[model samples]
Target: MQDQPLNAADFDAIESTLLKYGDDHSVLNPSELDGYFTALVSSPEQVDIAEWFPGIWGGQNPAWETPDEAKQFIELSVRHINTLARQLAEDSAAFAPRFEQTEHLGHDVTLAEEWCFGYLRGVAVANWTPLPAIQATLLQAISDCAEQDNFELPQDLDVVAHQQRVAAIAPAVRALHDYWLSQR
Candidate 1:
């Protein structure tokens, strides 16, 4: 397993591959993929790759042009999964969701909607259920961000509120990881 962390170039390659083969499917981008993998790793119950891999391409596997292309995708994804698992286990603070950077009201802001949505997707795939009240609340923080549609902020949500929810996601995820770790 190529456990070296994926650099920018690797992410670009993954993004390019998704765009090239995604067609009309709702394929996850690099940032979304990271969150998805994080949730899968943090899941209390182990999820098999055979079950979750298809979810990346929106319930179907992409048809790569060559065997090597498929191989590279699998390698990168497995490496990322392992990296997240290791980070969450060794140093939960080191685990950060890959959020997209953008400008909001003339200030630089990081948006986590896509990443949060991907995480929720993983949770659904893992069939996570019956959580204790505290852990449920932690997961709800990520859910708050996930509920927003792309580029469509809720009318009732001011910038401050939105930023607060986004800020809470990382800590909530870390706590969730810790909760599951303690269970094991």
Candidate 2:
């Protein structure tokens, strides 16, 4: 099951389940989880499931309502991880980070903070070494978005600037993935 890509129903189930549990736990939401998995898949060194699985619930396993529920969650998560790896390997252009969408100043914008944070979390879990200067610059782009305060935006930030910064993330991600692939 981990080798198979999740269908729409499976994806929806994973998202809904995370939301259901997120109320009382620190579990990653769908978009954040997607980013987290992306980082793991793109890392030059592979991370073991045991090391990163606990990150889904912020370092603790949830007391699932049933064994089957836990099984399903694990299965879906593994499948998603595999799917990310396959996408990045076969068609990097098809890769898209999951982001929350909302209107800011009457302009549609993507909220990448959580997703970026999740990616950073995965980076930490992977214990990556110092990247080359160019790769480091690409990573800095992601770090900037992740470091934004949850409630406060920079005073000078305009909608267009924000969109431009968000737009850079995908290309940066693709480049970073390529860099890591070359390293491997």
Candidate 3:
């Protein structure tokens, strides 16, 4: 809500850069980064960039492959996501979490899971507080969602149900935010 507004153009280049270099090294996509940022800073506790960056960039293949521009992307993304957290906390109707995926998938598994994983990693690095029951449950749900089990989808599994589960990220983020705030 300051001089810079959270928008796509600021991060659009990162995706293109990832396409050029590849996103395999990166644990999170642009969209997940945004969600993760909100999850971290939305809390009352201040999350240091030093603490969170390693979790975000760790395990990335071609470890040093990230260009300067990519680093800038994270900086800009933090700013944008901070703004997003403010909006969400204020119950702004215009707040919509951004996703890096261009096309929709029949089963968008990674969308919420990666974002949650990023959030989990951030929380791990901060280690400032313990999670309440709801937060713990959501984290478990996301972990389940992220699993890449080599098995067929249940024939009767409802697509709507799965989508609903994935769609819970925003609310879950809000809950975590409130939890941390209350602790503070």
Higher lDDT: candidate 1 or 3?
1
Q: Residue 28 lDDT in model 2?
A: 51
Q: List the global CA lDDT of all models.
A: 0.83, 0.84, 0.59
TM-score of 1: 0.92
Q: For each predicted model, how many residue pairs clash, with residues at least 3 apart or on different chains?
A: 0, 0, 2
**Evaluated with TM-score, which candidate comes out highest?**
1
Per-residue lDDT of model 3, residues 1-184, tens digit only: 2436756676676555545545554543666566566667755577776666655555343344557765665667667656776776677455555632322335543245555555665566567465668788866665565562313455555667666776775666666667777777
- Deviation (Å) of 72 in candidate 2: 0.8
Ranking by lDDT: 2, 1, 3
> lDDT tens digits, residues 1-184, model 1?
4778888988998898877776454555888888898899989888999988888888888777899999998888888898999999998888889999876656566789889888988888888877999899999888887777748544454777667778899999998888887776
Q: Write the per-residue lDDT of candidate 2 for residues 1-184, one digit (tens) a residue.
A: 5788878799789888788776443545777888889999989899999988887777777788999998998899999999999999999899889888876555677889988988988888888889999999999999999987645555466878788998899899999999999999
Q: Cα miss at 19, model 2 (Å)?
A: 3.2
Total backbone clashes of candidate 1, pairs 3 or more residues apart or in separate chains: 0
Say what the RMSD of model 1 is.
1.9
lDDT at position 120, candidate 2? 86
Off by over 4 Å in 1: 23-25, 152-157
Better of 2 and 3 by TM-score: 2
